[model samples]
Target chain A: MSFDTELAEAQSAIGDGFDRLFAATPDLPLHRAMRHAVSGGKRLRGFLVVAGARLHGAEDALNPALAIEAIHAYSLVHDDLPAMDDDDVRRGQPTLHRAFDEATAILAGDALQTLGFELCLAPGCHPDAAVRADLAFSLARASGADGMVLGQALDIAAESAADPLDLDGITRLQAGKTGALIGWAAEAGPRLAGADIAPMRAYAQALGLAFQITDDLLDHEGDAGEMGKAVGKDAGAGKATFVSLLGADGARARASQLVDEACDALAPYGKEAASLIAAARFAISRRS
Target chain B: MSFDTELAEAQSAIGDGFDRLFAATPDLPLHRAMRHAVSGGKRLRGFLVVAGARLHGAEDALNPALAIEAIHAYSLVHDDLPAMDDDDVRRGQPTLHRAFDEATAILAGDALQTLGFELCLAPGCHPDAAVRADLAFSLARASGADGMVLGQALDIAAESAADPLDLDGITRLQAGKTGALIGWAAEAGPRLAGADIAPMRAYAQALGLAFQITDDLLDHEGDAGEMGKAVGKDAGAGKATFVSLLGADGARARASQLVDEACDALAPYGKEAASLIAAARFAISRRS
Candidate 1:
């Protein structure tokens, strides 16, 4: 099947899984806010998980995919709080704090984060308890101080810095802020199958950087309506981004090169990684 | 050893554990905030984990004990946010948000929550991977909705309710808000040993309720100087609490009965539970 078709299928399955999980929760306003926060996303991370799992022999990828999406959703909800990025809209919908009150938003984000760990640890996510623990541990590193949170903290601190981050600095920050989770999602298959992670890690590292560069490219030129949220936000804030450091044309060229590297890293899987290669190409080409 | 001495050892061990974990992180302002948030607490939850684990012959309880404390600390930092409880003081010191900025406070809480799961999944927490997964899963449920979060959400909603929560309603909320984590801590020993949870569950149920009643008693009548945070806030806000519902005398009587039941539940363990019995009594008798 085409990568687009596979991605859509993955998104549908993951959405259904989330629905099933959240349906049993009490209909309190906080719960409602949580449901709303997870309601919309491209589910690219979920697709990465499911597709990566398929590359291996894993059949039950729903739980890990769900866990990754929950983590992503919680990050977005917290990042959009008034104290953080303060964005009022996300994925074309009102942000959680705007839709619900700030306290509910904060608590919902906290609960959603716990839910991610719970889903990973819950039975059916993995047959071996060792794999489950590994998954949870990996996710914690990707999302915690040494990764995404550190990146965010740096980003916030950078805003008032006397010197703007250069290319290397921006790359490092984006690696943590955006690349870490993507890298984790891409390695899910190997982790679950108890296979060597080197090849998958290589593929993910390249793919993650490529994804962020393309994201910067899109933000530089994409229309706000098409992007679902405000575009050119980084440039407007005078923030250092790939496009700003490399120029739009140079950024595009770099993303293309990284995509090639990503595809090459998957050669160990031979022809079976075709869809993943397509995903790499699509990463740079998509509008959103 | 006396329960006080044992509790002190647990506190010191947990404190050192936290210090070691945070010491390696980059000393960014945000990291400093996180360290501060976990610095001071009675470490009551940690004591429960160690004491409970000791009862079941589980060694190396430090990791899970640290995990529980991290979860507890994160909840406190968020609960004291301006948008939440809006308190400026905690444990006789400035609250996290007051000590650091709001953004740092939010990020610190987020990272601390993630750190809890990481510590639980880390090796040395348990000998078996299955046990680790179980620990993570249980902590999630206790910390997430259907437990603490659910209770918090209900409490927020109750503030604007036309009718105040009755005695039963207040009991249910307190059980979720405060009792969930305590119950989980108390059950850690049985869970680690793969033993029956019924006895520990009963003990925790009684102990948790008794703890809350005493807390209510303290909130209603304790001095602000000793309590650290404001006292009589619940009554000032017209919120329903055990003391408000049962009155101080009745609440004390109920707490005394609960202590008895908690002790009785430990009869299965006989003299091995002496320190736990002392801890139970201390739960109701302590001034702060």
Candidate 2:
């Protein structure tokens, strides 16, 4: 199958799974908050999880893919809270607190986070509980203070700074905030498939860096309508960006270089990893 | 050892473990939040955990005890948030958000929660990864929306009510908000010890109910100087309480009955559960 066909199939399946899951618990106001926050994203994290599992020779089952995506979705919801990013919109829709109340938004974020672990720990997944534990641990680390939370704190601190941020500082911030979770999705596949994780980690690291640099480039030049979020937000906020420090053309070139490095890191898996490589390239090349 | 002596030992051990754990990660601001929030309390929850573990025939290890207490402390921190309880003081000290900023409080709560699971997943614990998974899963559920978060939402909704709450409503609210976590701690002992969990669950359910009722009673009549918090705040806020609905005398009788029921539930385990039984009685009788 073509990478596009596979990606579409995976996205459809995850979207359907999430809809059912949210519908199953309709009485919870927090569930509504979660649905609002999660419904409109492009499912990049979900795609990476599905692609990673495929690369490690695991089938794209409903449970694992949905669970990983739920974690990603939940993180975004909380990360966009009034106290965090204070974002008014997400994926072209009003943010959770804007759509609901702040209390509902908080509860929704908390519930969705629990839902991620619940999906992994639910009966009838892989029989090995160790693997389930490993998946939960990885997601927790990615979302917690040592990783995404720390990155967010840095981002907030950097927003107020007068000095220009260095490449290393920006990279470290993205690695913790974005890269940690993306790397987690990739590493999860190997852990769940009972495969060695070294190569997957390498691929994940390169892909994460590529993803962030491309995101920076897109924010600089991409259309707000196409991207589904306000473009030029980083510069307006005085936030650090690869394009700000490295110039637009240099940033674009660096993104392509990172994408190539990401693809090369997946070479050991032969055709099994082709979709993941393609996805990494698409990640850097896409407008949004 | 007598229950009092054993409780003291447990508190000291937990204090030492937390001190070392906080010292180990000095760089993160969240770690400082953990330390500040954790330092003031009487360690009642820590006592319950040690008491529970003793009932299940587990040796008192600092690790599992610390893990459970860490979760307990983190919950208190989050529960006191402006969006949650809006409390400024706890145990005569400023709450996490009061001591630090709201962002720091949020991150600290997030980090401490993850730390709880991380401690459980640490390699030195028993090698039964399934059991560890179960422990982590249980803690997550008890702490998350289906448990404490739900109770908190209900509490917020109830805050503006003029009508006095009935016994059933208070029980349901406290069960999710406060009881579920205490129940989890009781069950944690057997799960960590790899013992049969049936009796432990029974003990936990009774003890949790008893603990909340006792808290309500204490909040009604206990001295503010002794309790380290303002007493009569529940009645001042016009919040529903067992004492409010049942009258102070009825509430006392009910609390005594619950203490008896809690002690009776532990009878099947013989003297091994003595500490737990005594702890249950002490939980009800103590001023704070």
Candidate 3:
């Protein structure tokens, strides 16, 4: 099957899984808010888990795939809080805090986070308990102060810093913010299979950077109508990004180079890893 | 040793452990806020873990013990948010959000939550991978919507309800809000040792109720200066509580009875569980 077909299939499967998970719970407003926050997404992170696990011959990747998606959704919800990015809209709809109340939104995000860990630790995610523990451990690092949260802290600190972040500073910031989770997703197959993760790890590091640069490129040049949420948000906030530090053309070139590097790191997997390679290519080419 | 001696020792050890953990992290404001939030607790939950694990002959309880403590601290920090309880004081000091900005407080709580899971998943927590996974999995339920978060949501919902909660409603609310984590802590030893959890589970259930009743009694009768925060806040808000529904004397009687049941449930351990027996007794007797 083509990469697009596989990606679309994975997205559908993950979404269905989440729908089932949510349906099992009581229909409290908090549950409703969680459903609202996690409703729709491209499911790229989920795709990474599913596709990567497939490469390693793991049959039950759906739980971990949905787990990563849940974490991604929770992070987005919290990031969009009034005191954070203060985003009014997400995925072309009102943000959770705006749709519900601030307290409900906060609780929804918190519950979603716990749900992520629960899914990862569930027996369905992987047969090996050690693998489950490893996933939880790696996820905590990716999402905690060492990774995504730390990146957010740095980003917030940068907004008021006397000196604008240079290319290196921005690169470090984006690595923690954007790269860590992606890195974990790409390595999921190896983690579940108890296989060597070096190749996938290297691939993910490059792919993550490419993904962030493409985001910068989209913000710099993509039309707002095509991008769903407002474009130029990073620039508007006066925050330094890949585009700001490296220029639009330079950023695009860099993203292309990283994509190549990402694909090359998967040489050991050869033809079996075609979907992952396509994903790296799609990271830079998509408008949204 | 008496429960008092054991509890004091556990508190000191847990505090030192947290201090070391925080000291190793970068000196960011978020890290500082996390440190502040985790400081000066009585470490009752930590004691539960250590004492329970020792009963089951599990040598390495510190990691899981601290993990639960981290989760508790994170919950408290978020609970004190302006959007939630809006309290400015905790443990006789300014709350995390008050000492720092709201965004920092939110991030600190988020990071601390991740840290809790991280600690549980670490090899040091348990030699067996299955044990680590179990800890993480059980924690998600206790701390998430099914447990603590659900309790808080119900409490919030109750505040705005046209009708105040009856005894049953208040009991269910407190079960979720306060009972979950305490239950998790009390059962940690069996979880680590892969022993039968029925007895410990029963003990925890009764002890948790006793603990909450004591809290209500303290608020109703103790001085604010002694409690380290405002007293009579629950009654002031007109929220239904065990004390409100059972009446002051009735509540005290119920607490004592529950404490007796808690100790009775630990008969399986007999003389080996003296400290736990003391812990049950201490639950209703604590002034703060």
Candidate 4:
């Protein structure tokens, strides 16, 4: 099947899985707000988990796939709060805080993070308790202080710092903020199989960095109608981004280089890893 | 050892554990804020884990002990946010958002939550991967949508609710809010030992409910100067609490009866359970 078909399938599966999970709980505004936060997304992280599972011949990737998506969604919800990025729109709809209220949004986001860990640690994720523990441990590391949260804090600090983040600083920040979870997602299949993650690890690092650069490029120049959220905010805040530091052409060239790095890292698997390679190529080429 | 001495030791151990854990990482406002939030609590939930561990002859309860306290602290940090309870003081110190900023407080609370799950899943927590998974999984459930967060949402809803909650309504809400984690903490040792949780579960239920009633009583009549935070806020909001629904004398009577129930549940352990029984008694008699 084509990568697009695979991606679309994973998206639907993840959405269905989340629907089932939330529907099992009592109906409260907290649950409703949680549903709203995870309702719309590209599900690219979920796709990474799905694609990796297929590549490694690992069955029952559904739980981990849903887990990563929930983590991604929770990060977005918290990041968009008025106290954070203060975003009013997400996926072309009002942000969670705007759609419901700040307290609801905060609790929803909190519950979503726990929900991700819960799903990862679910017995269905892997029959071997060790594998389940590994997944949950890695997830907590990637999403918590040493990874995503650290990156977010650094990014926020940079916004008000006397000096803007230099290229190295932003790269480090983005590695934590975006690259960590992406790396974890891609390597999850090998983790489940108890196989070496070196190749996928290298592949994901390049792919994740490329993904962020492309995101910066889009935010720098993408149309608001197409992007479904605000654009030019980085520049507006005078925050240094790939586009700001490297210029549009420089950023584009770097992204292309990183995409090449990503695909080449997967050469050990040759064409067997076609979907993942396609994902890397697709990351830089998409407009929004 | 006396319950007071045992409680003091657990508090020191948890504080030391937190210090070591946070010290290994880079010092940032987020970590500082997390430390602040967990710093001054009475650590009643943690004491339950310790006392239960002693009763079941299980060592290495430190991780699970710290995990519950972290969860408790994170909830308080979020609850005291401007968008939530909007409290400015905690433990005689400024709340996290007040000491730092709102954004840091949110991220700190978020990271502390992940930190809790991470500790529970740590290899040192148990030799059995299944046990660690169980601990982490149960922690998530007790603290997430199904439990603590649900309670918080209900409490928030009740403030603006059309009518004050009846006794049944408040009981259900308090069960989710305050009762769940306390129950989980008391059951941690049996869970670690792979023993039946029925006895501890019964003790925890009564202890948790009695604990909340005393909290309501304290809020109704205690001095802010002594409590180190706002008192009378429950009545100030006109929200129904155990004290509001059961009157002062009635509430005190109920708390005493529940303490007896808590002690009675531990008859299976005989005098081996004295500290836990003392803890149940402590729940009502103490002020702060």
Candidate 5:
């Protein structure tokens, strides 16, 4: 399928999956919190998972894509909590806690985190229990203490530090918090699809770094309305950013170079990986 | 080994595991929340898991036992959130969010939940990847939406109902929320130990119900100081309880009956199941 067609189909699947997920939970406070946190965004991570899975020969099973996206969504919900980013709004709507209560928001995040794994292990996604287990292990590693949680901890610590952190420190921090999960998504699809994972892992790493660098640049230059969050909040907090360290032009160059590296890593898979390559480029170029 | 020796050993292991868990995330707010919520528990759930594994003829592995307890601890922390029970105290200390900020507590709970699975998948637990995967899958199923989350949703819905709930209603609610995970602990050991699960599952179910019945009875008859948070809170909220339907004496009777059933379920396992039998009895007899 063409990239546009594939993207269109994935979007439809996500919409349907989300509708069922919401229906399953109904209008409870935690359910509402989940809906609020998941309402908008490009679904880039979902697209990447789908694209990677297709490249690696996964069939029409959209469960893997949905599960990966759910984890991404859950992370954003917790990341925007009052104790983390403390944002009152997300994707142009009041954040989960703001819409409900802080406690509800917390539970919603917890539910979604677990739900992601549940979706993966739901009855018939894979015949081999080991695959489901691997998916669970990978997701936990990406989102837990050594990965996203560590990144969040570092982000909290960075917010209060007076000294300027070096580029490596900032990179390592973002790699854990943001990059780790994205990379996991990319790698997960291929693993489940029975593809050789070496190239996919490399591509995912570059794509993840490129995605974050672009996000940093967008925060520096993008419109708040377009981004669904205040653009200058990072600067306001006086935290380190790629754009801050490397300058806007330098950051853009770095992002583009990373995208090129990401694409290069997919060469072994040929045309099957075209959507993934387009996704890497899109990650760096998208307004949001 | 006697229950006391096993209990002491499990407690020491839990103490060390918790020390490492807290130290790993030393952000002051997060650490405080962990300390506040994680301390004061008797680690009964951890002991149950160890005993269950031992009953299945596997030597105690501290990592798996600690992982099970971590899930138990994380659930308590989230369950006490304002949107849920709205309690300010647990085990006589301020709840996680009460001791720290709401956001910190939320993140701490999230991290802890993920940490449980992470600990299970950590290096050196089981050499077989399939066994490790089974552990993750079982844990996720027990704790995720279809299990605990569904029960919690039901509890929230039940709280606002005009009519008093019956014994069945209360039992179903607790079975999912509290019983599912407790049941998971019992079966997890056998699953991990690669032993037959049929007997373990039966024992877990009976023990889980027995524990809830005793809890309801305690809420009616126990002291607030001995029970930790306010006693009779359930009655005050007009939520259903076994005691509400069966009366205090009846609830106690049911608990004893269930304890007998739990013990009977373990009959085929012989002396190997002694600690599990004792733990089931202790679940009903404990003050806290």
Candidate 6:
């Protein structure tokens, strides 16, 4: 199948998986809010998980995919809180806080995060206990104080600081914020297989940086209606983003270069990593 | 040693464990907020974990104890948010949001929750990978949508309901809110040893109800200065607590009966379980 078809199918399957998961939960307001928060993402992270798993053998990546998506959704839920980003819209719909109340939003975010770990540890996620532990441990590292949250905390602290961040600072911050989970998702297949993750790690690091550059580019020169959220937010806030530091053309060139690096890193996997390569290319090509 | 001494020691050890854990983190506002949030809890849940581990003979329950407390601290941080309980004080100190900012409080809570999972999955937590998976999986269930958060969500929903919750409703809510984590802590030792959880489950259920009853009783009759939190708020809001549903005398009697059940359930452990029995009794006796 074409990469787009595979990605679309993966997204559809993930949506179905979530439907089954929440079907077991009571149709309460908090749960509904959780469902809403998880909905409408491009499912790129979920696709990354499946793509990684496919590079291995017949491992069930569904639960891991769902797990990563749950974590992503939880991050978004908190990020949009009034005290945080305070965005009113996400994926073209009302954010969780706007849809429900703030308390429910916070609870929904917390619960979704727990659900991510629960999914990683569930029996169906992996047959080996060691692999399950590895998944949960790696996920916690990617999400916790030293990883994703560290990046976010740094960014938040910098917002009130007098000096604007230089290139190294922004790179360090992005490494924790967006790149950590992206790297984890990319390595999920190898992690499940107990395979060496060096190649996947390299591929993911390149892809993550490229993805962020593209994101900054989109924010610098894209559309609100197409992106399903506000654009130019970084520039509007006078924040230092990749585009702001590198110039839009420089950012685009760097994204292209990183995409090539991502594709090159998958050389050890031979022809089977074509879709992953496509995913790297798509990261830079997408509008949103 | 006496039960209070043992508990005080456990609290001290857990505090030290947290210090070591945070020592590795960068000294940022978020990490500081997290430290502040976890500092003042009674560590009842952590003590339960250690006590359970002691029964299993030298299981090194410190990691699991820290994990439980981390999760507990995370819950309290969010509970004190302006959108949630909106409390400015917790454990006689300014709440995380009050001490730092709301965004930092939210990030700290999110990171702390992840830290719980990280601690449970660490190799020091258990020798067996299956056991570590079990620790993380059970902790997730206890904290997630189907567990403690479920109870919190239910309580939030009821706050704005047209009618007050009856006895059954309140019982169900408390089961998720307070009872779930208490039960999990009680069963931690048995879970580590792969022993029967039935006795611990029974003990925890009874003790949890007794604990909540006493909490309601304290809120109804105690002083805020002594409790270190606002009292009579449940009564002020016309919320039906155990003391409201069952009058103060009735609540006290019920708590005493539940305490007896908790002690009786520990008959399986016999004389070796004296401290646990004392812990149960202390639940009803404490002023805070």
Best by DockQ: 6
Per-residue error for A210 in candidate 6, Å, reads: 0.6
The model with the greatest lDDT is 6
**TM-score (chain A) of candidate 6?**
0.99
Tens-place lDDT per residue, model 6, B14-110, is 9999999889889899898888988977899999999988876745899999999999999999998999989987898888898999999999999
Q: Write the per-residue lDDT of candidate 3 for residues B38-93, one digit (tens) a residue.
A: 89978999999999999999977999889999999989988999899889888899
How far off is each candidate at the interface, as Cα RMSD in Å?
0.7, 2.1, 0.6, 0.7, 2.6, 0.5
Residue A206, model 6: lDDT of 94
lDDT of 4 by residue, A1-76 (tens): 8889989999999999988988887778899999998887788888998898888888779999989988888899
Q: Model 5 shows how many backbone clashes?
A: 0
- Name every residue pair that clashes in candidate 5: none
DockQ scores of all models, one per candidate: 0.86, 0.53, 0.85, 0.82, 0.48, 0.93
Residue B220 miss distance in model 5 (angstroms)? 3.6
For candidate 3, give the DockQ. Answer: 0.85
| Residue pairs whose backbone atoms clash in candidate 4 | none
Each prediction's TM-score against the native? 0.98, 0.94, 0.98, 0.99, 0.90, 0.99
TM-score of predicted chain B, candidate 3: 0.98
lDDT of 1 by residue, A1-288 (tens): 998899899989988998898789888998899889888788988888888889898878888899889889999999999888898888999899999899999999999999889988888898898999999989999999998888898888889898889988888888888888988899888888888878878988888898899889888898988888878888999998888888999999999999999999999999998888898888888888
Name the runs in model 1 displaced over 4 angstroms: none
Residue-by-residue lDDT tens digits, candidate 3, A180-279: 8999898887898888889989999999999999999998898876776668888988889899888888999999999999999999999999999999
Q: In DockQ, how does model 4 score against the reference complex?
A: 0.82
TM-score of 3: 0.98
lDDT per residue as tens, model 4, B153-248: 888788777999999999989998999999999999999989889999999999999999999999998999789898998898889989889999
Whole-model lDDT, candidate 4? Answer: 0.91
After superposition on all C-alphas, the RMSD of every candidate to the true structure, in Å, is 1.2, 2.3, 1.2, 1.0, 2.9, 0.8
* Candidate 3 clash pair list: none
Query: Among all windows of ten consecutive residues in candidate 6 chain B, which has the lowest summed lDDT?
Result: B52-61
Residues B10-81 of candidate 2: C-alpha lDDT, one tens digit per residue: 888888888887676646556677788778576666677677777667765455567667767777876777
